[model samples]
Target: MHIAAQAYGRTSKTGLPTRELEATLLSQSAARLAAARDRRADDFALVVEALEENRKLWSLLVRASSAPESELPDALKQNVAKLGAFIFQKTIDLIENAEPEGFTALAEINRNIAAGLRGIPADA
Candidate 1:
């Protein structure tokens, strides 16, 4: 079964979907659980920061996408590209400092964000 469908599916016995349960696991209440499972606080921070950076990059992408391609100044595009590169490098540096668990967390968050952005039209 698809992950989303499985996640939201109700158990045959209890007739309760796992969505709410899974939400709690990934929610703020799961901080301890995340820490226990990962066994490192630095990894958790990397995950959180990567998620945040993804959001910031998303905003930039949306703004640039809305602007007319012809009207978008070369300098503006260059600056955005440069900023993205800088952020990417910073993310790499952060991952390097983190342990394996932390690096995995960062990579997962970054991949999810990238996948989400890929679904949206670049020109939109």
Candidate 2:
């Protein structure tokens, strides 16, 4: 199933609000990336798979935020687009160079965004 559709289905089944579902997905992506980063030395393929998943999640976000029917604010949509571009570039860079440190920014961004969606401070 498509990631967005799966998320929607999960929300409907669990009675979670859209924002909460989004936050949960983001957190899951972040955790996957972080775990892959930590285990990169043991298994490089994990990193690649995690990066692909993160990219897919970001792609969905970018498309949704950019859609004309989206309720996201213009500034937020622009920010998501910019972040998506960076994430795509970073994913390519990591795939090419295989730097564990590079995963930090990607995971951090997801975590911060998830926290925002949950109405919590990133640090907290």
Give the top-scoring candidate (lDDT): 2
Give the per-residue lDDT of model 2 (tens digit) for 1-124: 6565688667767889888888888899899899988998888889889998889888988988899999988999999999999999999999888787789889999999999998998779
- Native-to-model Cα distance after best TM-score fit, residue 73 in candidate 1, in Å: 1.4
lDDT of 1 by residue, 72-97 (tens): 57786665566456545545554455
- Lowest lDDT sum, 10 consecutive residues, model 2, at 1-10
User: In model 2, what lDDT does residue 100 have?
Assistant: 72
Predicted structure with the largest TM-score when compared to the true one: 2
- Where model 2 places Cα greater than 4 Å from the true spot, the runs are 2-5
What is the lDDT of every predicted structure here?
0.44, 0.88
As for candidate 1, its clashing pairs are none
